[model samples]
Target: MRATLIDDLPDEKLATAVADLVRPGGRWRKVDRGYTQAQQWIVRWPDGRSVFVKSGTDALTWGWLEAEIGVYAAVDAPWMPRLVASAGDGQGCGPVLVLEDLHEAQWPDPWEDTMVAAVVATLEEVHARTAPAGLPPLSDRRDVLHGWPLVARDPRPFLSTGLAGARWLERALPVLEAASARADLSGDALLHLDLRSDNICRHRGQVKLVDWTWACRGNPVFDTCAWLPSLHAEGGPRPERIAPGQPEFAAMLAGYFCSQAGLPPQQPGSQRRAVQRAQAAAALPWAARELGLPDPGDAPREGVPR
Candidate 1:
């Protein structure tokens, strides 16, 4: 009863794989309630040290997690947790990771401006470092959100309901297409593409980032947008959605600019516009597919959004 894939693979297969990865004197325990996959677990060693583990076999997920370790290691910031150990190749059944467990740390709820600022500033600092000129580029918005077959073809069935939702989705399409046109997969930055609150922790008065599945080199603005949904989800004392054009976003940008020094700030208006555009671009294609609307085919703007 350790952990098993949602693909309905036999529990024995998963247990065997977990057993193979569990080191001597280490135990893997199931941690129910996962966002991405069903087999998430906390691996505990006899010495009382523990690392979190998540598994998947689609693309470069295991490799991406490893790449995240590389990103944090390369950064000079104090915000990232130390890497422990990871398992898995590119494919098959048992690929997983065992990393430092920052249990005492908790995520910033509703992502207050202060929390957003701290993360933005930290990312800015991370982005400032120089790297080898050509690292294979990280996946963009489409790649991150829609790589799965269900997501790639259509997500509206899973994301929305009713005609009103459909209209909102429709209104958002052209903007999505336009923004995607500007997406450059070749752009590089110190990116934690999945910068949601769950993957971040506040430990001993320091902020630490975890969950590097979507980490990569790319445009920093794209990084901001990628983090936006979760940040918006975390905004406010009660933890509600952050409305577009709020002062909180301004503060977040202020913190990022403060850390970045020479970086030009994205105007709040422009950022909101970009958000709306990105939302549409990010959602519409799949929505159309979900609704049985014919795919418009890949235009110049139909590629992944950076």
Candidate 2:
């Protein structure tokens, strides 16, 4: 995915902004991870310094980039990625983010025990930090985070996934709804709403989290609850085995994934549906186990860690 001949790309605005730090003769290669609207790159200057760049390819990513920059500016933590410089604001060539290069860092794979422990420890420290001003609280996403209501409003999307038959879904709807309603996502802990293997890297004994567009504040427990589903899908421990004992929160997580697992991606090359379905596979069964609900069947899982 290397874009040789730097002159062939249209990064002039971003290049100019970082000209002092990243010299003109720098080379960059696309990271090529899909599911994002931004073009990510690892750029190396002739002077031997390197930096990661995230340039928005569309309006959605432009807004996301702006938010991510704010998160980096507001939080100074060991787990937070270093912010080098930023440019654009949706007015010129979209928004761009410059960050410390993490290419040499180890990204999680095979769900190693020590790495998992490091991640959890990092999260614990994150939770202890006082949230930056203007960060939204977890309660803001109460209804929005609750997925059973969405499924209840329109069961077609959930049903299409074949994770549960029509009869099974109908029989299980009441339990799902009740369990979700019992979830109260309220607390003052700083939160990383989006936690996945790709957004994480361990460098020099520190776990750095990239992609801050989804950072916020919420129940500390909710942060781990939300993460374990993806962890489970990636051959990590089940949500119950790791965090355990948050049946209501587990139901809410399941509902959120199930509600969108069968929907169409809003953009081309997006892995939204597949990832959501894969997460639903892990979360639903975990929720059922916690709540003693009936089986919700199964479907072939997709979007394992990459």
Candidate 3:
């Protein structure tokens, strides 16, 4: 389904939806940051209660919002925000999720050593929790975990774009593919799949992992590995120091980002390619270091190659 934006909602319908979660006289103030794929607002009711409202209008985003709803209902983790209420019709109308407003919470600064360690420890706790059965398999998301193999088979994207260290990537494709194949990505632990600092926040001395749409059944360690690139890009420790003894996982991630980085820009938000580029550039160094290959010294800076 196509993704919908918050502006797509009619004023009357949006009011009705908000009323379901907050008092009738409540007002919604848009939150300026941390909303990538959805619209977010802080709803302040007349009774002095505040809640967070996240609504997605596009089909793709609607589906993810629905999945998040299900995950929230199923899990009782204190580290996650509380789902207050929700409204949606499975059709194209999209879904709105109302959650407890973590007013004093703050996204951790990846550059801070203490905050980084805290985030890592929180991830380990999340992984330690047993995942409920029947969650979507991480393997099912071919675009995320398995795209590297296809990219390895066809080096056009890496070579054609003149990506930094393209020759190294071409040479290491087989080894990366082998690492991808040998990586043990299966497990009973619930994986966040996407674990950047933006999705994690500290609220009243507890780490809360928000954004459950990407939650899946897979190796929890993959979450840690996935977060390394963002940490590195943000001036934190290198992936090697953050996650030692996991070259295969790093290689697979490198391949995944490398595969997507050279693709044409996606529509609506042309930032997808840029995000992939940054992640790929950040991850390649880790993968190369781990694989004993040449450094791919940050070729693509956060945007489409010119």
Candidate 4:
């Protein structure tokens, strides 16, 4: 019963955990937003200030959390939440990050025209910022980011997902693989590889993007390219409507999701594979439409929100 009232944590435990970050009277509630393995909290002080906090407990979660903390420390852009405080070793492990609470922010699920415009505008702002030094280039991530080549090596996994029919796979895989190779992802701009509704919010009349662990330096278009597919998956406009005429990007994004959709879940109980299938479902058609390739008649509509 106490847990029900306090979001599964006692107020005393919350205060003890972040004693240095907040006043003694503050209370905290666990937040269940985004796809992070780190524990999240929204702590409200007696003075009416609130902060968002996350503790890096999981091994993988700690690494990503460290990267996010570095991005926060390096960039002072309005497109992200203000980093309030952090505590841990210099290395990226066993630490907690405190950020300006965005509990009041609007998470645009059923996106509107104006909201979409806000996100696009925010992306432009984000891309205009130079990536921090020491960050890896987008090209360094090709092994994981590019997928059509893997599909070509062994079509069985991708074929099992049913995003495209066997005939369509045999015919279209080469074009997509080739197009993926041609997509120039090289640039100095900041790229948020993960872009979805859960990672974005409209706050203080502007777009604030969270989840920066997958960030890298790449062509600015990569931001828009990666975003549009997930946008459509969540009921927004098609990829072409927001940013027209980037077939290479469409192909790349298509493969990024399609190749992983049929594979077993990387993490137990993760819905990411299903979401990838849905993103593939969204991207394949867009790629065909933009590239002037024939319709992927074998494409299945069996995908969920990415």
Candidate 5:
């Protein structure tokens, strides 16, 4: 679980380990975006072939990286990144996951309506595919839903910023909890818990989903519903248009993000808290709109919160 960067390893050893998977003489260039838990790089082979590499030495990230390898190995969908190679023990040096480099792929910009529809369709296709049973269950997120009850007892994190009045937030907690409890988070289909724009790409006229660390067996609709807050915050259509008639599911997700947003920062240079806060802010209004409650106003634009 020690923090180990690619530079910490001998060049020859690293090359030898990856040689079987990619062209032997490829160069590694760090990819500086959307990688929080691991070191990521795009490896370009001298032959013009390329692959994306994600390596993690910390226990949390290594575990997720390993899970990603399993998910990739288990599924064969066009919308997913093809797995190239992987290395690691369950523990120790951790794991390195290499995947197909999506050539000429571009991240969605301004999130036009057509692009949003494409993303939703792609997600639906992924959910339609049967998921292998051994994957982690959605029940693992139970703590996230149950955490709302505790917020009333300790309101410091939720009140520290004064973004929403403490009194209003307190009054909404019970309603949020009730709606969250009614949500059906269980399902047989695979769910991509993280579906932000950073993890999605468009290439060859198709949408592709990436970052399988949070992949799980859950209500597929939850995946689509959860994406609304981020989509709206990023200039896409409102939540009602993206996912309509799912107020309970939206409420559950709002609680999840709001609870996480309240926590203190977990690491140096980490934007997890800020991102969660933005999502929470964005989600509140959607939930309120669905529940016929007063609007909480616009959330900060999507990205790392300033």
Candidate 6:
């Protein structure tokens, strides 16, 4: 029987394509998302060991998780998933990655203090590694964010017109550009641009970091900054209104600095505040634009905000 192609395949078709890769009798179950861009699956082997398979278009940005395989190949840690096998014909529409399953891992609520410490330590160690040249730098700063393509791939057909949606992308471009100019391009160390807790799992008394596509060489502080707001929220979920200079932000800064080189906490003063405000202003606009919704503020101007 001819194998099914991976391109543009809906869930059913993609499931068929994946079946060809796994052993017979291996049942496949789809994993829901709070994280990532690829379609995830849980495959149970005859021996009962489960593995995960991810599939998506071959776009460099969406295909970033493939980079995680390479990264895991380069780094040494007991906490990260071991890359099993990856197959992709860059020319064909079918690109797939198969990795060791982490179905047994579980993370406690409020995140254990040791777990948090371990995560910070891992980030510090990973960020210290030298990164390959020619790849984009991993920065959470404006420069890093701006350097990425403004248009992300949108599979959906419509756009949102809500206030939270309209002002998001429309107001964000300028802020991103301005932040990029002042961003630190120094110290090309390997960094995980996204370190949200959802990507972390606890297994066998160890913590594992998943999702590696956004990993790059850049300033570590920005990566630290990204984790602060989310990790400190109630139940580790982001809050609707996070006041500046709050204890939550302070704890994140303390965790980051103390976990690594012990630098004093960088207060989220004007500069960081500006970045936050700019980001908040941009979110709604981005959502609207992503859905292809009409923006009332789509006027052309010399110095609108960037």
The lDDT per prediction is 0.47, 0.79, 0.73, 0.79, 0.74, 0.50
| Tens-digit per-residue lDDT, 163-215, candidate 3 | 56555555667777777667777788878877776677888888888878888
Better of 5 and 6 by TM-score: 5
How well does candidate 2 score on lDDT at residue 104? Answer: 79
lDDT of candidate 5 at residue 246, scale 0 to 100: 89
2 against 5, candidate with superior lDDT: 2
Name the lDDT of candidate 1: 0.47
Which segments of model 4 are wrong by more than 4 Å?
A: 1-6, 10-17, 90-93, 297-306
Task: Give candidate 6's whole-model lDDT.
Answer: 0.50
Model 2 stretches with alpha carbons more than 4 Å out: 1-8, 88-91, 298-306
TM-score leaderboard ranking: 2, 4, 5, 3, 6, 1
Cα deviation of 250 in candidate 3 (Å)? 0.5
Candidate 1 residues lying further than 4 Å off, grouped into runs, are 1-23, 45-47, 54-77, 87-96, 131-134, 138-172, 183-186, 236-306
Give the total clashing residue pairs for model 5.
Answer: 0
lDDT (10s digit) by residue, model 5, range 66-142: 88888888887889887888877412345767888874487776687788889988988988976787888887787
The number of clashing residue pairs in each candidate reads 6, 0, 4, 0, 0, 14
TM of each candidate vs. truth? 0.56, 0.90, 0.86, 0.88, 0.88, 0.58
Q: After superposing candidate 5 on the true structure, give the runs of residues whose Cα lies further than 4 Å from its correct spot.
A: 1-13, 89-92, 298-306
Question: When superposed on Cα atoms, how far off is each prediction in RMSD?
Answer: 12.7, 4.7, 4.6, 4.5, 5.2, 12.9
| lDDT by residue for model 4 (104-189), tens | 78888688899899989889898998999977899987777679988877777777766666767777888888888788889999
